[model samples]
Target: MTSQPRPGPAVFISAGEASGDQHGAAVAREIRRELPDVRLFGIGGRELEAAGVSRIAGLDELSVMGGTEVLRRLPGFFRLQRRIEGLFVTEDVRLLLPIDYPGLNLRLARSARRQGRRVLYYIAPQVWAWREGRARKLQRDCDRVLTVLPFEGPLLERYGVRTEFVGHPLLDAPRSRAAAARDRAAPGVRMTDSRRVIGLFPGSRAQEVRFMLPVFAEAARQLARRHQDLDFLVARPPHLPKSLYAGAGFPTAGAREVTERSWAALTKSGTITLELALAGVPMVVGYRTGGLEWAIGRRLVRIPSIVLVNLVAEAPVVPEFLQDRLTAERVAAELEGLLGERAAGRREMLRAFDVVRERLGDPGCAARVASHAIELLARDQESPGRLGTPC
Candidate 1:
């Protein structure tokens, strides 16, 4: 009997941040399901590990955010990149999938390409948001790019990058299994009898927590005062301490810390909006950052929508409260509307969300990405000197 052709090509993935890790993990799992013998390994966090990916390095261990933070961690980042680049040369990794953390991942992709490895950028960078020129470099480096946004494809095309709009992964996952869960009756802290749950997601970064958590807590207090019967749950990432929320003044005693349990999430922007949508948990999204950061982002951001649900749905299905507008009063009002099943706004939003969820395509995004990587590997081997065509 043949030895299964030595399993398939070895594909390496690198993802940073909680959202990237989740998306990367989904892709890795799908690849395994599609090609049972495919060799998959990566540098990721708990999400990829739980998805059965072999860890080359823990992404969380190397995470640094914001311009100033990244500058502070430059030496360590360089060290990690060198180690990753060394792995590409010595391990002979045929293909590389670099998920959203464009700064670090882009550099790694460039290094991998230099070592003659095919690169597929899963969850392409938000180049359209700012630094649109990155598209040129991406086209020069990567073999293929998979974008979840419909608008991103054309932007990448201008730079001659090969890109595909893989339906948003949020549309693909199983909805949160938790039923109507209402066990809380107050805002600062309260207990309820109903199973209807409200998700509060401050964010993954400490800075975000600093800026948003207190507002979120105050909003929850207001929400509890008005509703008095909704359960509040926080989907805490492993990187954040449970005490992180305590100082923010959101009662943590009865509030569930849903690391990997229950469903529905009230999260910051990015992938969580999509996750909450996929989970079928209706949410009111909110975000807050430093004034300087907001001003800088405003000048750079291209899109009008901040919520991923709106971006994926290409319309507003969920209300987004950002910056100064993201207050306890605003959050409470929005949450009240969503939790109020009879509210027409809530009905309309949920109805649109149902349609959006179906559009996410299939649940095997990571697998499809994996298969794509393997195919690229084969083509690369057939023509070692060819550069991939831009999208």
Candidate 2:
């Protein structure tokens, strides 16, 4: 008897922002490592490309943030979705991996499901925050919701999605300490010093850069007045123009590098805050959205906190300044307090970080997702997208 021929290895991944790029790259990297012959293709960034994924669409093509940004980029989103749906049919896509960027992924999931394809949504959408109705739609559209956050499983499962809390992808990321020691030259300037470092991550989206970088720059300027020994490192995400951070006037580095070196930081409220937390860097999280968007979100969001570190720990270890509260003076003051708040204060915060570490589960998240992908490849379910258990 002859052995059956192996199925073609093709997985479609979509990651529309810097954070997703970083994450999707890791999963792609792991999938390649585990199954050497597997082929990965997607819409992602430089990181994903480096991880061996062939990009049909660049991150810049789909990267948009804020309600206003999404509205303006609607045509581009539709075009990309249609093109991806076509690829699913043409390439015989075995599995669909949509890493965050829900607005587009949900539609893509719906289309892929119509094609009788399976979708594993990494970093599940914030239906818990707003649009609770979509949770059920996600269940209907996806085979498995591979969430990184601990709270998502219970919430999404309650709504009927087959969910798995695969810990956070950041847990499997390369150590900040290992690479932070290198005084590498990046988009802006090079860092070479013994002085302590403070990271200023204003966020990776263009809208976030526009709304937050000036405030961060001014705060950095003020903080420099008092702490002359401190060094500032800003993370410049891929696809952004070099001029984007030109006014910030600080040495720029990759986020992972800066997170390792920074003793304390004033960062935009997002996934970077949680990455910093995992690295044991105490932070003051800040964010600003369009006035109308902020007002509407404030009413709709169910959670009391926006900072992921605080949400994951179920404690206020990281301070947050949002919208009207994200003023330069206040941010500078918070950073000052965080840096000089005494060694014990930093130790106490780091101790709380231990809780965050525990909550995120262990590393090897991508490896597990890779295993799930392999299983999906073998099993052809004519029913909905549901696969087996998360392991």
Candidate 3:
């Protein structure tokens, strides 16, 4: 009898929040396209599940951010780390795809190396902004780093990590522009009906949503008093329960739709700001963490601008509020200026949006990442244990 075909290579991925889940799903979709029979399992949210990646480990367990919060969950983190390490060993996994959650994924990468697994880190960490020391560790742990930002390649190269600029995945896979155009052109749709809609993205994490939504709602309430026709839409992450927004006042939409319909967005600074920028929606960025974490982060983070849009452009395209500066009244005032009625302000923001989109590069980032993974897998088969060399 002819010998059976060898089994497809084993692989595992890990991502932390809903944003990571979305990007992980994008990468998985492409990986499936390249290697139809490849094993794709990961710890991510609903989006990854939809893209054919099974959630062997829960995303919620790793959803937390902030130093104090992370410290509180050290025991659980250690136990989870052991559980993941055991899975990698037992599965005989050949590859590890760790997306944007650098805090834990870096450790997992080291463990993967120890177990003879190759790692391709998608969406390199913000070492350019904070915790610059981690890039040196990344060089030792990961086989290659696929970065979204155009500038990150040189930065990581200096630290000795083999890196590639995959371009921003969002640029290649824009959600709102075409859909918003179609919606505007549809027979029944009317901008007047929505009436100066404002999108609010408090955040994707449960703790962050709980902290920011109430404050955001209050700002919306105040803005409503000045502009009676103003409507509000909260962009809900797929992983969170609607109960998270139970008392917080606003209609809800998927993150993509919120970008399509809103004239302005009141946002918590995060990766979603890049989405908002891509949508060409003028917005005010703000965030709050536990007081101690905020204090600690302030001391550590070197960047003057926390908003991704601002950092990418190296210009203050939008305002940022933090700590004592982030207040309902202050946010309400800033958002009121970005309202659809403020033609001058909205026009200026759109000009800034064009600059961001150009820097982001075009779509097809997912496919590039897939190509990298496929090449890495082929090499692992070629050399067996010599898998960690620069890809």
Candidate 4:
């Protein structure tokens, strides 16, 4: 009998949240398009599953925000980590592609490096915001780091990390939707329909939703009382149960659809702020967490602004309320100034958003990421010893 050819190498992807799942799925599709027979597997969510990645674990078990919240789920995370490490062995995973979720992915990268697996980190951790040492850790553990932000490449390179600016993935989203919204309501022209929509984006994690949804709802109620034509829509994450949004007193929809129709938004800080900016929605950003998390975060975060839009714009393009300051009344007050098409704050924010978009680079971010991943895999195969050393 003829000996069978050896099975091709498999890739393990770890995308620990909703946004990462979307990015991971896009990259996975692009990867398969180039290498149809390559096996893709690991931890992700519904999007990854639909993209043909064999998930060993789901985001439901892994997605949590704040240090204190993660502590509560520590035992489960440890178990999942061990399970993933085992999959690396059994599945013969040659490459580890980690997308964000630095908390767990960083640990896994270290483990994979020890096992002679090459690691390519995507959507790099916000080390500039906090724990700046993680930049060195990423350099030590990852073979290459792909960043979405324009400035992150130079920052990571300073730490001697192999870095690439793949451009912001948000730009890949259809601009026509946002463009149409803007066309419908030009800078000086109010909506002829006499109705305006406000999107309330609570965020993807359970902790974020639990902490932010009620406050957002209350803000919406306040805004509703002041303006009769204003309508509120909640951008609900698919993973969260409907009951989580049940008493929020607003109609719930997918984030993209809500963003496309929004005149302005009350949003929780994080990637959603960037998404809202991309959609040209003037937004008031807010974030709240458990007391322990807030106390610890306030001390650790190095940057003055937590909002991504402001960070990208390199200016305070939108109002941000965090921790103790994130009251519904305060959010409503800030949002009130952004309610009109001709509102000064709204017009100025939209202009800043335009600058933000221009700086984000062109689209095809996922394709570039996939190309790099494949190149790394090929190089590893040709000279395994080059990436074999553990950090």
The Cα local distance difference test for each model comes to: 0.72, 0.81, 0.83, 0.89
Residue 216 lDDT, candidate 3, scale 0-100: 91
TM-score versus the correct structure, for each prediction? 0.85, 0.90, 0.93, 0.97
Tens digit of per-residue lDDT, candidate 2, span 157-239: 89888988888888887666423433232323434554778889988877788899999989998988988888888887867
- The candidate maximizing lDDT is 4
Clashing pairs in 4: none
- Ten consecutive residues with minimal summed lDDT in candidate 2? 181-190
- Model 3 spans > 4 angstroms off: 1-4, 175-194
Residue 118, model 4, lDDT: 91
Measured by C-alpha RMSD in angstroms, how accurate is candidate 2? 5.2
lDDT for model 3: 0.83
- Could you give the C-alpha RMSD of every candidate to the true structure, in order shown? 5.0, 5.2, 2.9, 1.5
Q: Model 4, range 224-251, lDDT digits (tens) per residue?
A: 9989999999998788889989999789
Displacement of the residue 16 alpha carbon in candidate 3, Å: 1.0
Q: Which of the two, 1 or 3, has more lDDT? A: 3
lDDT of 4: 0.89
Candidate no. 3 TM-score: 0.93
